[model samples]
Every structure is written in structure tokens, then in C-alpha cells.
Target: MLHTIKQYFNRKGLRDPEYEFLFEPYTGEEAVSFDCETTGLDVHHDEIISIGAVRIRGNQILTSEKLELFFNPQQEMRVESIKIHHLLTCDLVDGVPLEEGIRQFLNFIGNRPLVGYYLEFDVAMVNRVLKPMLGITLPNRQIEVSGLYYDKKIAAIPQGNVDLRFDSIMHDLDLPPFAKHDALGDAIMTAMMYVKLQHIKYLEKF
Candidate 1:
């Protein structure tokens, strides 16, 4: 585990202490908005089935540069999970092996900060595979869209913070509604949220 962690830090360019603060005061040329679909929600027990991400630059989502991958999980899928991600065991027949999926995901993300709603879980799932399969971990800085939305709301209205639910934020921002539970759809929603949050005046100051 220690070796894996060390290797991850090295691979992600997170060896520098300053890198820890990279996502706090967001300043960057590009940021990758990400989301994932999993077999279940328990990070300790469940497994990731698919991952999707899109890079945002200059207030635009670079759709042409998106990354989407289906992963073969070591565990069997729970029936309930199918309602969410729509990935049945049969659907994953062509899924990539864990190591290849991790490597592709890492290559896609590179050193850029990762953005997602509830990102820690996705990061943990990725780490689970990386540490065991490749003796590495995912070390990229993470930005949670939920937190960003809450911060933006607080800044906009000094009275009180609003709920960070995805639906709430989408309704508030007037973003086009889409069916949830799909990785690509969620990633696109996250990208839209990130753009909308950036336009918030108080958030722009930072």
C-alpha cells in the first residue's frame, strides 16, 4: 500500500507540497469535469463500472476531448444498481480490464485537477483498483461540484446556504434537464454546473 501510494504521488505530479492547495483557489487553463457509474454506492465494498469526463476550457466544454470507459468489476452487480447506471453484467462483456481502465483514465486526466459531484467516492474506487492492480493510486487534486455550488450560493446570498442537490442546482441554474444515473450525462451536467458557478460574481473574484 505504501509503495502504491508513493507511486501514485509520483505519477500524478503531486510530490510538491503546494499541489495540495491546487483546487482551493481555482486558477487554471483547463479543468476536467468528471462523473462515474458504479455497481453500488459503498466505496469500501462497491466497484466502479464506468467513468466519464470532459475538459472545460475558456468557459466551454470540450466535448471532442471527452473520456468514457466501461470497466470490468471483480464483483457481481446488485440488481438495484441496474436502475441507476443501466450496466448489467452482460453489458460489460466488452469492458476493459481494471489495469487498462485505470491507465487510460490516468492518461486522460494527466496532472489536471479532477472535478465531480461527490468526487471522493469516485477517487476512492479508482484508487481501489489502482492500488491492487498496478501498485499505484490516483493522486490528482479533486474539486466537488456540490461544494462549489454551495459556496457559490452562499456567496450570492449571504443569508444562508442552499442545498447542494444536483437537481436543485440544475433547477436554480435553468440548465437543461436530463435523465440521471448515466455517467456521461452526469459529467455533462457537472460541466454545465462548473461553467454556471464560474459566472457567479462572488465566485469570479476568486
Candidate 2:
């Protein structure tokens, strides 16, 4: 279908053939749950400062093996953003360059499907960096935890609203609130939500 065509073009125009494995059909069950801390919400102009991801295979979350990467933005982060992400420019002074961090991330993820909460923004942020460097965006399939939650939740109350806020969803799922909302912590928590949601059948009654 569309992906098959995109894959063909991506393979044909690949900047580095060494990354050809990315175009390879992923036959594995693993999905990477990832999150990125960024300078701002605008995907057109903002930059990612750090990325955190973990792998989930079947029902198991492999917490022992995880990817946590920080990049040197080399500019002062906005005070409001720093308040939320707690990643100041000073803290990332020794962090790796954006391209290096991105390479490490690509290696860590391979071709696994990606799962996340509000995943579109993060994917957009990564694609902005990836499109120029690789001549293609991530070909990995995406599973949005919030979307899964909505499908599972709206079965009983088709006319009612479902609060899709991160905290509200976590609370409804009975998962523990994260101590602080960093990229890794949020990614891990979102993975938990994904796993739990997979086991829950949609009930007709609330």
C-alpha cells in the first residue's frame, strides 16, 4: 500500500545505504516507547534537547535496556520550558551533538514500531531532524497510547467526553503518577499504559 511505495522511494533515495536496514520489513513484536524533551512546541522551529526510549516485547517491558540521550542545545532554554523539563543549557554542556544523539537513537530503535502518548508531536520533531539527514522520515509504525485509550474508553459513553490529558489517562488506567515528568519517566509510564490497555477488553457499560 502507501507504506510500501514510501519504503521503495526511501530505499531508492537513502542518503546512506548502511541504514538500509531501516527499510527492511520489521517482523519482530518489539515496539519502542519513546519521548523527547524539546525547546518548544513548534515543530517548525523548535529543537529536541533529549530523547528517552524503552523497548517492549510481547508483554514484557525491558527496563534494563533503555536509551537516554541528551543533546547540547548550545543556547539558553526558555524559562518556562526549563521549568517543565528541568534541562538547562548548563546541564547539557557536555552532552552529545544532535546528530550523534539521533544516530544513537536510530541504532537503539532499529525498525521496531513506536508507541507513545501524544506521539505525533515527538515524531514530527524527530522527522524534522531526520528528513534532511537520511532523506526519509522514520518508517517505524506508530501506536498512540491516547488513541488506544480513547477507543477503549468511548465504547460505553459514545456521546460523552473522554479526558485525554496525560495525568487523567494515567489515573484512569490505575498507573502510578511519575515522580517528575522527564522524557524517560513519561516514556516508561506511557509504556505501562500501553501494556495495560492491551489486556483490557472494551466493556459496554462504564
Candidate 3:
């Protein structure tokens, strides 16, 4: 864990004493399932349009308490990107600035372990904004839902190939589908997946 933290800082060209708290071990019980809607796929150029997350305490997903924040990205919306998330510049005119949006997200998540389908991309987009403001990427540990599903599946069928698609996983687990391409809906669905995966006998034995 320490090695990963050092590598992240070195790659990002950052050094800060106050941000060291992020490297400490996480002892909390809560985990946040999060998702981000961005302008495009290029992390270096695209900016976040929204962030949604829900918290899980043990096996329960606290849907009542969730973060759904929108931001005004000062960039032209791509036609393809607009088709994916359906948010245009005009739709985000009244949204908060990136700085305020990020601050609120950080406050909502704190040090809780983060869970998501493909978390690295989301984390990278978040860190792109956070590195400049906080001098650190997310300090919280991240748990990929795909990884959890893979572990459980491979255990059940040692030599069988596993399907890791979001829809496939949800279907296999008997979970209902939620609205895709929407941050809040996706976050809640991901949260549900995490809770269910935790109760699997294979995971419980470990």
C-alpha cells in the first residue's frame, strides 16, 4: 500500500507533508460506491460533468444519503459524449464550478473505501482535479466491483471464463437494472452489487 502511494505521488510530480494522511491505513467500516460522468474519455483533456456516490455501512446501502453533484465544465461538449451522458453545456449553465463540486465530493467521501465497476478511470478523472487543489489523490482505498465478481465466479467454476459486464454481473446476481449513463443511478446500482457480493459464501469464508 505504501509503495503504491509513493508511486502515485512520484508519477504525479507531487510532494506534500500535510497530504500524508491519505497514505495511512484505513480502519473505517463504511464504503462509498461512486461513479463519474465526464465530457469525454481522454483524462488529460476531458473534465467531469457530474459525480454521484452512495454509502454502504456493512451490508446496507444508505440510498437516502447520497451525493449527486453537477459541474460546469468550461469546454465544448462533444457530440459523441453528449450522446453518452446527455449533458450539454446549456444544461450545465447553472451548475457549480469544478472547484466547489470537487470540494463537496471530497467532503462526502472522506476516508471511506471507494467501490465502483471500473474505479481506476473514475479515480483518475477525480485526481486530475484533486491533485491541483489538495495536492493528493484520493487517500481512501478502492474496491473494484469487477474484481469482487471475478473472485467469486472463478471460485465457483475454477476453469470457466467469467463475464464482467455491468449488466451481465447484475443479471447473474439477480439484481434489477438501473438507468445507465446517469451517475446517481449507476452509483446506487454499483452499491447494490457491492453489498450482495459481500454476502457470497465464497467471500464470507475469506
Candidate 4:
């Protein structure tokens, strides 16, 4: 099934070679900001309910190029998870099947590096689906905004060491207000942080 999907994409001229990052100067153009809402935080046991992503080029979000997918989970959703993402099982009537959603997500991402908050877990959930269904792993580089903010802060403030909490970064950076755990809201916040960090990087260089 996965092979046929890949072949279809290839036939449509959608397959691109993987990206190689040389030891060159950094630029913000080649990044895709993404976020996932799941049935729970446990990547080992929980399931993804929906995913949203936007490609950021030159510090601008290409809204027209965004990808949004809702996946029907194999497991039943816990009450707590539904309260968080608001995706009831009944709400997923139009959602794509898990396999098809994964295939579309993989094709949308292609070889672009991913940007998100605590990205490893999302990547793990995505790979969990792929490894079983497609017999392949996710093949994109990832950048965590949480880690990047921490590194930037540690470099900027040598004397004041502070843990990098999401709320802390949001407050410190004067980022826009957001709903605590909404997938699309988080994705937009992550995109905003990425753009702000690029400006900070530029300042440090100049």
C-alpha cells in the first residue's frame, strides 16, 4: 500500500532527493513548522488525532502551503485527551484513514527539515505509524524550538541560567497569546518563535 502511494507520488513528480546540510551559514528559509494533537502525550501508547504544519520561508509563513490532517486512531480516546484536542471520535467522520494520512504527511514533508516544540515525540509517533505500515522511517531533519531557545538564551545570558519552559519562552519573547494545548495554535506559536529567533540570530551575527 505504501509502495503504491510512493510510486504514485513519483509518477506525479513529487519525489525529491533528501537534503544535505553543509557546514554553511544558517538561514531560516529551509524550515517547515509543524505540530500534532494526540490522544495523549504517551508516544509509546497514545495516538495522534490531528496534525498541522506550515512551511516557513525567509521568516514568512506560507499559509497557502499548509497541511492539515486528522487521523482516525486505532485506539479509543481517553476523556482527558478529548478535552485537550476537542476531537471526539464522532468528529472524525471525515478524517482520513491512518495509513492514508501518514502517506500524505510524508509526501507533504518530503525532505524539508521540520521545526516544532518538543519535536522528538511527534517524530516518534509519525515514525511509529510509518515503521509498521510502510516499513520505512521518517527521513527528515528536525529542529526543536524549545531547544533552540534554550541554546540561544544560554549563549546570550552567561550569568542567568533558566530552564526553558514553553510558557517562559513565550513570556520572555513577548509572543502572542495562545490557547494552551490546541494543535493549530501551538503550530502558529512555534512559527512565530522561529521567526523571532531568526531575527535574534541575525542581530548576534551583525
Best by lDDT: 2
**CA lDDT of each prediction against the hidden true structure:** 0.77, 0.88, 0.84, 0.73
lDDT of 2 by residue, 16-122 (tens): 88788877779988999999998888788888998999999899889997999988884567778888898888888888888888889999999899999899999
Stretches of candidate 1 off by over 4 Å are: 1-28, 156-161, 202-206
Estimate, for each residue in 1-206, the C-alpha lDDT of model 4 and write its tens digit.
88656534433432223312211224445677888888888888998889888878877887788888887777888888888777887887688988788777766766678899999988898877766665455556678988878777767666676666776777777787676666666777888888898777512220
Model 3, CA-based lDDT: 0.84
Could you tell me how far off, in angstroms, the CA of residue 98 lies in candidate 1 after the best superposition? 1.4
Candidate ranking under lDDT, highest first, comes to 2, 3, 1, 4
* TM-score ranking, high to low: 2, 3, 1, 4
All-Cα superposition RMSD per candidate: 6.1, 1.6, 3.7, 7.5
How close is every model to the real structure, measured as TM-score? Answer: 0.80, 0.95, 0.86, 0.78
TM-score: the better of candidates 2 and 3: 2
List the lowest-lDDT window of 10 residues for candidate 3: 10-19
Full-model lDDT, candidate 4: 0.73
lDDT of 3 at 198: 87
Q: Please list all clashing residue pairs in model 1, or write none if there are none.
A: none
Can you write out model 3's per-residue Cα lDDT over 1-206, one digit (the tens) per residue?
88785757644554645445455566878999999998898999998998999989998899988999988888987888889788888888889988888878877887678999899999999999888876667767789999999998888778677888888888888889976668989999999899998888552121
Task: Residues 65-90, candidate 1: write the lDDT tens digits.
Answer: 99889987778988788887778888
Model 4 — TM-score against the truth? 0.78
Single out the weakest 10-residue window by summed lDDT for candidate 1. Answer: 15-24
